[model samples]
Target: MNVSQTMETEEDFLTRLHIKLYHPQQSCKGLYGMLPLGKRSSHPADVPLRLGRDAQACTYALVDPRVSRKQLALHAYRTAQSPDMLFTIQNLSQRGRLSVNSSALGYLERMDLPDKALLRFGEYEMLITRESGEAMGSFEVEFEVLEMPPSRETCMCVPSVTPVMELRALVPLENDETLCHL
Candidate 1:
């Protein structure tokens, strides 16, 4: 080898997403055996990460009423300075905004995804992590369709941003209630 020539020390790696959902509203309980709370799954970066209330359309489904049928999607790309993956998140919700790391993303709005992000929407919180390794060459979710574990609340209760909010001055009646987005 010539001393003037520089050898590449970094190996190319495929992008991967590690997604885990939290704050399961009662409506999402039916997803118990299908989409359990805190079940982390790794997905190939080549594929877009989709999430919403529809099981058939969304890659990760949540049945919460406050959630939109097609909530959001994430697409991955590469940069000159990094080998891992960079992502951009698009909000697809018709009724609410997606809060990424405390920043609000309205419908059809797109934002550059950080390596790690805290996504909040409709009483649901999702923690997305970036993972890259030479061994992750295939485009597949880490787990099978039916491998979700039992439903449980593994996350702590904290004030989080939701797409919609309604705070009444007096006790709200079942019939006299109005929803206001904050």
Candidate 2:
């Protein structure tokens, strides 16, 4: 189901955000088991942030709420396998309009705004701002559904034997090279 259908109120919106941030399984089908943390920007000048695994190389530019009238951009970097994708969700709360523009994908024009705005594309997660607050409100912004690589292992075997037989095997052998013959 689309987020609009499932999410109706501020509380529901917050709950969905929590689930998308913390519990992946309950949010979407393909994203349930994927990595949720990624490398975050460390520049002191940048807004303090935390990232999920799926957000590698993604950059978020926060417009000062005081300066800008109403717009935010999430500058996301694409991986080598996939072209750079910028998934933008514009929310004009005063006019009550929301739109999504993606670089890899086409545009989702002028979707009517409900109460909040959320956009999810592949591993990318984004939530646009609607109102200012004392403490910055956070939302899971990027998610990448990556298939974990397979792992390998090695094994060795030892036989069960009586202590006497084992002692006999351990005795000094005529030829050192023949010690493994037992």
Candidate 3:
């Protein structure tokens, strides 16, 4: 089976446990962690048991065996090479509030994140604003995992189109006023 087919099977497995799954196309190389939220009354068994990140940084969803249907939120954290790098949150639903908490606050003052950088959590898209006081951009995001069809026939050997060739050429150099040969 192909990559798409594998994705479908994984999605099926997650759905069986009633967990809302999201597949992120972006790489997770710099991601730190994710906070998944569910109904307060729900038991811990309803939470996702595993979260996977591939070598290329794609994120996959896995659910606990006992989870049931419920509204949930995921706070995914990421790290970058430098503070100048921007972080973004996008493709949120049109319901609920998105909140952000930073690790630091100034003396006698709470460091407030710029409104533009703060995403409302439920919008279609949200971004961490640029440092120059500009609004962060947004884009529509969608994910799909499909199954691969079984192969009807198989082939073994394949022929090469072109034979390998090796060649060497002498280098020529130019002098200040005349062409020089090396």
Q: lDDT of each structure?
A: 0.60, 0.29, 0.24
Ranking by lDDT: 1, 2, 3
Report the Cα lDDT for candidate 1.
Answer: 0.60
What lDDT is reached at residue 26 by model 3?
A: 20
Decreasing TM-score order of the candidates: 1, 2, 3
For 1-182, candidate 1 gives per-residue lDDT tens digits of: 77646554223344456666555344443643445344445566577778787778887776565678889998777777765556799999978878887689988999998866767776566666666644333332332221221122222122334222323333244432112212
lDDT of 3 by residue, 135-159 (tens): 1121112222212110101100111
Q: Which candidate has the highest lDDT of all?
A: 1
lDDT of 2 by residue, 19-129 (tens): 122222334543334334442212221232322222332233221222123322332222366322222233323332322322222332333322233343322334332
Q: Pick the candidate with the highest TM-score.
A: 1
How many residue pairs collide in each prediction?
0, 9, 3
Task: Report how far residue 82 has shifted in candidate 2, in Å.
Answer: 39
Q: For model 2, give the 10-residue run with minimal summed lDDT.
A: 149-158
Q: In order, what is each prediction's RMSD in angstroms?
A: 9.9, 22.5, 22.3
TM-score of each: 0.59, 0.21, 0.16
